[model samples]
Target: MPGALTGIRVIDLTQMLAGPYCTMMLADHGAEVIKIEPVEGDPTRRFGPFPEDDTERHFGGYFQGTNRNKLSLTVDLKKPEGRDILIRLARDADVLVENFRAGVMDRLGVGYETLASENPRLVYAAIRGFGDPRTGESPYVDRPAFDVVAQAMGGAMGITGPDAATPMKVGPGIGDIFPATLAAFGILAAHRYAMVTGQGQFLDVAMYDGIVSLCERAVYQYSYTGRPPVPEGNQHPILCPFGMFPALDGRVTIACPRDSFWTELVTVMGRPELASDPRFRTNADRLQNSAQTVEIVESWTRQLTKAQIGQALGVRVPYGEVNTAADIFADPHLKAREMLVEVEHPGSARPVTIASTPIRMTATPGGVVQRAPLAGEHNDRILAGCGFSASNIAQLRESGVIS
Candidate 1:
């Protein structure tokens, strides 16, 4: 089936979370993504949550989660012949995405300037810890960074966690996701430009910059008051009874921004008199006594399940039941929206259940069509499409250029 990006070809030279994630989004929309790995393969291959325990063959859950609906290839870029072949592949590729240290591709003779010379319509993209070469390579560009480094330096760590005493990291790898999303946007922009002007351009996204963009609104109070924001745990600083409360089962986060919702909430708990009380009548007044207000709310909520609170508050006041992995896995809304899909791993008999795509199209909707590839599984298949013969591919394999 033809996808939205069906005619596009992306040469993905990224591993781990950020780069592969960007390419996956392109593939999800119908790009022909050919992931190029070193002879030993992407380091992610060695990462675990392996499908099967074996003396030899293994694949990890992280690898499977990000990489799907993409073909794979292996080429040792350190080798001159391998570099030659990569340049050839670049000619027909619509985009080239790399997350290596700034000079890695330039050193291998496959940098954007060289690649784009042959393919003027190519969108060359790079993801980096700080920024990339085309952005005037930073002095720290040589230092490679993963999600944790970006999160720590990019203002995310400063705002997370409770009380500002022990700052905590975000639960997911947003450091990678943010950069990938920005890169995807850049790619689309470049694609539009190429369609009009027949000129390709470099698109670069720094993980640290991406993280800062995501946390842009963190200083809502500080920007006006010159007072830095501090963590107030699950509580919103100015909103009364608008945070996490203990339920019979666990925590249920509730929010009642307006006095009307607070009145309804108080009524739900049979506390009409408390809603009428001058000390808790308005949001400002209630914020002054939030601790007492939450205790009052929890006094009733403690006897109920999160589901009970969610049911009582649904559409009446904004509330969400704090859910664990099990709760999310069993969520009816997620099932209805196709937010979970099952795919059989190449090395496993049983299927793996993973989060599904968030993209939805009225036409040309895509689903999980195949399992994530085994390491270098499509080396021949991808290279053969670029016009390599069987004997040449065999010789290249023999030269230890590919695994």
Candidate 2:
């Protein structure tokens, strides 16, 4: 079956994580994403975790994981001819996405205004550290930033660690990934508007802004209490027993924000009377005596392994074991859901496993149907589609406009 964005053509002029990930989402759902790389290629193409014996090094794990289902075209946007090529490609493209620092594309002569002139219905999107001036001028507009900067500046790191004094960056690149996810949604929404009105607009997503949005709870907490929220370790600030607890083997999480669930948890813990105790009866009471509540929960949980605790809680309470990668790989639920998928490695005999798209559709299902492309792998094809002849492409390559 054809995918959801089967007919949509995307001109992807992005590198690294944020922009590539956003375009990857579109490509996974059947957009014809053309990734325009410089001669050196996206820096991630050299990123590691390659198979032990693989020597070709066409792409590494980071590139493969995010750049799948996209075509590769190398163009030197520094050159006027290369800029012309991009403009020509965008003339008919449904969308164009980039993640350069604000004003870089405009300096290269392919900014949204220039492209929108070529295609009135083109949805030109940018992912930046702060944001583009066209949307709203940011004080840090010209500053370069990455995931860690966004985390620190945007409140995620402020409320992430065990304590307020020791802020810690998140393990995953949520700063980039979350903004990418939002950008994908924004692009789709803008594209839908363009399809209806025949007018496309430029859209921007600031990495800092995205992280602030993700830390929304912190904002409301400060607003209500007039005190900036601090990291409260593993437990939630308001709910009792709503965090990680120790098990005989590992850690497990239990959440009981409701009285009924709290009652059910105590009953399972072999302490049904605690459900009626003044210190732990209602959610508010449990909140006031949270330390005692945690001690009681831990006393029961520490006596059981994660599996044992899971079996005891079963489906009555909200619970989950802290899952490591090994645990996830061995989980029957991941297998049942087809979340893990294997793709052919370019130079290795063993196929590499990567996560599959979670979006499922009955009529137009989308997924990883192709591997990440080799650098400039589809240059000829993409150029041809842009109305350049074989001789023209050869000349462009000879002139150092393309690799």
Candidate 3:
């Protein structure tokens, strides 16, 4: 049988993080993804951390992380001819993914409504900052948003720091990655549905909405207890001893989400008394005295190395060392899982490892097959395959229709 999406074709007109990541997921699963870029190219091609390359456009680690296993094509979408090509591709493509601002795609006449009219079986998926206009326009739809904007506005920042007085934004691109993942899930679901019914639909995924979901625990706390949630800094607000604690050499995390695990942890720490003390007995009591409980736990943990802490706790209490990228690079578990992938960059002249696809499928496994394409690197070849003559491609390049 073919790989999961071998017959599917994706027209990717996305740049930067969110939409690129969504389409990249599709590509990893054997989708024929044609990543369309502006004639100048996707801005990320210039965004660092660029390799030591002489070429003008190449992989930034960020771009390489998200975009791979996809063909590259360049077009000037500002012109009618370029838009026409996109329309033609969309008519035959299984999906179209975009992440333009609220009205940009519609203004360009390539929005869902326009394409769906021509190809009723096309899955038009979009990622937006917030206020996905196609569904319900957010009040902030007109405002521009980046990763941090979505994290902060969507409540991720409100309860991620030490206290209400010092709300902190999440460290990663929570906004882009979460919504991109959600959008990919929606696209896959839509693809399944379209295969069954032969009728495609629009998918609207908002980064802010996704980040909001990520902070839903805070929502539950505030709505139920009427208390503003405070950041515990890598710890859960409700679960004591459920976060990072200092170790002799480095830090590690310990989680006691279950009563039995708590009992086991305190027992191992030679603090079995904590298991019966009225102020620290049950989970509820522990929550009430969370600071003291964590302090006590950390006091024990501080004497041991992170590895020792993890070994003592075992998966029985879900403990792990706080590893850096260097630590990750040296990790045996990650190596066993094949989670680190090596791809060669032109300038580096050596392979650099990036994270691998997280999902595992026995039937048709997915992986990073290549580094990101340079700006319009495959433009001529792809356009020629689209049935343009060699001279026509050259003419388009000469006319600035493509670089």
Q: Candidate 1 clash total?
A: 0
Q: TM-score ranking from best to worst?
A: 2, 3, 1
What's the residue-level lDDT of 223 in candidate 3?
96
Provide the clash count, candidate 2: 0
Query: Which lDDT tens digits does candidate 1 get at residues 1-403?
Result: 7778889899999999999999998888888889898888778877777655333444677888888888888889999989978888989988999998887888778888899888999999999997886776677777889999998877788777878786778989999998998998899899889989999999899998899888776656668778876667888877887888899988888888899999988887777888889999999999998888888988888999887888877787788878889999988999999888998766666788877678888787766666677778898887798899999899999999888
**Pairs in steric clash, model 1:** none
RMSD of each: 2.1, 1.0, 1.8
Which candidate wins on TM-score? 2
Relative to the true structure, candidate 3 reaches a TM of 0.95
Model 1 local distance difference test score: 0.85
Best model number under lDDT? 2
lDDT of each: 0.85, 0.93, 0.83
Q: How far out, in Å, is residue 287 in model 2? A: 0.9
lDDT of 3 at 184: 90
For 1-403, candidate 3 gives per-residue lDDT tens digits of: 3457788999998988888888888888788889998877788877677666535446677777887788888899888878877887787889999888888988988888999998999999988887566688678887877899998888888877876578887778878989999999999999889999999999888888898888888789889999877766767777776888899998988888888888899889988887888998777888898889889998899999887887887766778888888999999988998999998775676677788888878998877777778778888777766677898878888888888
Q: Order the candidates by lDDT, highest first — what do you get?
A: 2, 1, 3
Winner of 1 and 3 under TM-score: 3
